[model samples]
Target: MPEETPLHERILDTTEQVLRRYGPEKTNVVDVARALGMSHGNIYRHFPNKKALLDAVSARWMHCFTESLSTIASDSKVAPAIRLRRWFDTLRETKRKKIQDDPEFFQMYHTIAKELHDVVTAHVAELLQQLETIIRDGIKAGDFHAKPGASSAAMAFLQTTFAFHHPALLVTRVPSDDEADTVFDLLLSGMIAGPVSKKLRPKVKKS
Candidate 1:
């Protein structure tokens, strides 16, 4: 016989289905319990409230989304520049695919994200840490120049590419792959260190 799924996992799985059907606003513990054939009190035992349940679901989704990128970020075998570019490309494509394949889940995620600021904030922080790792490696390899620190450079990279991966912007319009590549190239050019043509160098104003 196959091992049974844990009650906690079942609750989260059922809660995701409920959110997909009714969205975050209408979803509640009772809905999840009804779907799972359990009492709402049982759900409270696993998750304190609806917000906590939503947070867990959102965190799980984010973990799935970030897992691949994490692998790319830590891949020392590849050049940092190449890995960085691949990271952003993967991030953009993942978000696009998620939206295309399951729009209801995507919209539900957006609604939950708005209500659960802490969960969103934690997710962003995790992404930044991954980016920072890649950037610090790049600096060590002399592929990039970040004078301040890897953390700040990582922030810059994320903020610059927000249009491609951010849920709100993606919901409004998904940029073409070519457009995302162009932006990544532009951002990379600024960070990469080495001999550069005069035109590519930033001109400084005389004091």
Candidate 2:
């Protein structure tokens, strides 16, 4: 016998399909309910309202990205420098691929992400905490001499790479792989143990 999908998951799955079909502007609870072959009230039982459902969907989507990064962050076998590089590159690549691969779904979640400000805020906080962990590991490994505490240094690193990580900016101004690599090297050099030479810094091209 086939096992039935959980009701809550069914609603979320159907909602994603509906969002892909009708987009954020047009998708509603009723559409999701219809797609799931259930009454609107049934969806409401799991998700309070249309906005709540969309918020859940947005959270789910963002978590997927965070989970991927978390795996890299927790990998102790990788050197701090290489792990940091992979983390940044994976983040930028994952976001870019989402938009390029399924623009409709990306646009839908991007809209919901704005509407659910707290969700986005908490997501950023969680990612920042993960970055702090990575920075602390780098310090313990004698890779970074970040004078500021790990949390502060992590926040600064995130801010400096804002265009690459921030969702709204990511859609329009995501850095190229070469650009990310150059900026990462410059930033890490400043935070690395001991003195960094001028030769390590890449010269900025004139516009």
Candidate 3:
């Protein structure tokens, strides 16, 4: 006989399906319990309320992308600049694929994300931490010149590329590879440690 799935997993699985089918507004613990052939009280045992259940589902979805980014961030064999580019590309592609493959779930998740600000904030925090790791590695390797700190640099990187991976913007338009590359190259130029090109350098004042 196969091992039974844990009650917590079962509840989460059922809740995800419920949310996908009916969206966050319509999904509830009772619906999950009904689908799982258990009492609503049992669902409550695992998740305190509907908001908690939705947050778990949202977190799980976000984890799919975070795990992949973490791998690229920690890959020391790859140069930090290349890894940073790869990280950004992977994130943009993952979000686009999720939207293309399961639009309903994507829409549902976006709704939950808007309502549960903390969950989205936490997810962004994790992404920033991963980004900081990559930036710090670059600074150590003498490939990057972040003035203040890796943490601030990481925030700037995310903010600059917000349109590519942010759900709100992604739903509106998935930027082309060329566009993303142009933006990334411009951003990378600033962080890269080297003499600034005369054209890009600020004009000095003449006395």
Candidate 4:
């Protein structure tokens, strides 16, 4: 006997393929059914409408993003800020390149861009909170600031403060990796009074 599969899971897989190839607007129940070799009516049985299918697709995208970021935060060799900037740059370049290289993907992305931004930004804020915990730990371990409640200050830091101000976070006019590191350090300077952020000013060298 063969393993039985669920209708919803199969529907989800079909929708992902549809979104990648055709994008959100063009991906409808009929197209989804065609991709899965099933009837249009059958797709409706699992997902009430096109919106429902796209909703599921967005959720899957979020879960995949979180898993990747979580892995980076766990790497023992890398500092929190370094790992974060790498991932942040990777994300901005990936999206910007996708838009530049593919028109259809670009259109599909704009259709869902606001929704995607909300989901991604929330994850970023969560990552900042994780970084805050690391910084706070360093403070308690005597590698950071001598001031009391310094750890709490790091926890209260705003995600936008670094993200908007830092060149590393910009999708447009992305600086070289070296420039990005400088920018990351600048934003982190005043924010971190503890061990990790203690070096507020690294002398900038001009070429």
Candidate 5:
């Protein structure tokens, strides 16, 4: 026999449908309850109120991105450099797809994220920690050097590539994929643990 769906799961599913149809600003417990064919109090039993429900929805959305990145981070088969590159590319693609696929929902969550400061902060810290783990592994493998702290390097890499990851650039002045790869290589080449090629080598003036 098929297992019954949890009430919270049902509530979340119905809430998403309501949110997508009417937007988070206009969505309410009554609407979600009506969609689920239940009383609004039923939703409250699972969630304190609308904000808590919305936060749970936003968190569920954030995890979809993190879960993929976590797999890349924990995979020992791939080289750190490759993992790093894939992580950056995947993040860019995820944001781009979200904006392109359901622009209204994306905008609604974008606004919600700003209000969900703790959730957003925790999510960013986790992403940065994953990046730091990759960088730390690279340093241990002699693939990277931590002249300036590996943690700092990871932070720098994330910030340098912020344009591709930040929601602010989700719809505006985004760089082409080629441009992003070029920038990644340029920054990454400096961090790698070996001699730079003449082409990548910075010029030094003879005194």
Candidate 6:
């Protein structure tokens, strides 16, 4: 006798692949069930409808991302600098597998009413807030620059340097982890560049 595969997990796994390839519009229960080697009727037994399945998948993804971030933040064995770097690194990595890459996702959902779009945007906004909290803590500890407001600085850094999300902005002959670390250090410290000193500007002492 064949072991029964769990319906919810199968649906979500299928949805991930479908979102990457086809996006939301083409992600019907029949297609997902076909992917899982099950009948469409069987899939409906797990999820009431396609929209319910889509919403559940999106929610589950959010929980996973948040859980991962929370675990990293609480890991005491990691040094603060390494942890800080990890924060940006995780953001970069996540962008590679993001909602934006799923064309069918955007296409299918965008065609719907604005409510769906608003929900997606709100989810992202919440994640941004969670990361900003970490940045604020770093600032308070004097490890990160706190001049330009922690939230603003964190958003700027993520938006500007996260290569996975904004690949076009990432200019470099070599894009390695070491290279990224060096670049990030320069950006963070160079932000606090000191003012030019008039006395040190090749000035002759007045008699």
In model 2, the clashing pairs are none
Q: Which candidate wins on lDDT?
A: 3
Prediction RMSDs, each to the true structure: 4.3, 5.9, 4.7, 8.1, 5.6, 9.1
For candidate 5, give the lDDT of residue 16. 85
Taking all chains together, the TM-score of candidate 4 against the true structure is 0.58
> Which pairs of residues clash in candidate 5, taking residues 3 or more apart in a chain or in different chains?
none
lDDT of 3 by residue, 1-207 (tens): 123358777777888888778877887888999999989987776678888888777787889989999999999899999999999999998999999998767877887799888889999999999899999999999999986779999999999998999988887788999999899999899898544667998998999
Write the residue-wise lDDT of candidate 2 on 119-207 in tens digits.
89989998898788888999998888886578888888889988887767766765787888889988888778534456985778989
**Model 1: clashing residue pairs?**
none
Selected candidate, larger TM-score, 1 vs 2:
1
For model 4 the local lDDT of residue 161 reads 36
State the displacement of the C-alpha of residue 60, model 3, in Å, after optimal TM-score superposition: 0.7
TM-score, every prediction: 0.89, 0.85, 0.89, 0.58, 0.86, 0.57
Residue by residue across 8-45, what tens digits does model 1's lDDT show?
Answer: 77888999889878877899999999998888988887
Query: Which clashing pairs does model 4 show?
Result: 144-194, 144-195
Candidate 3 structure, TM-score to reference = 0.89
Give residue 204's lDDT in candidate 2 (0 to 100): 86
lDDT of 2: 0.81
**Positional deviation of residue 188's Cα in model 4 after best superposition, in angstroms:** 2.9
Ranking by lDDT: 3, 1, 5, 2, 6, 4
Clashes of 6: 1
Candidate 4: stretches off by over 4 Å: 1-10, 20-22, 75-107, 115-129, 142-173, 194-207
Q: Distance from true position, residue 92, model 5, in Å?
A: 1.3
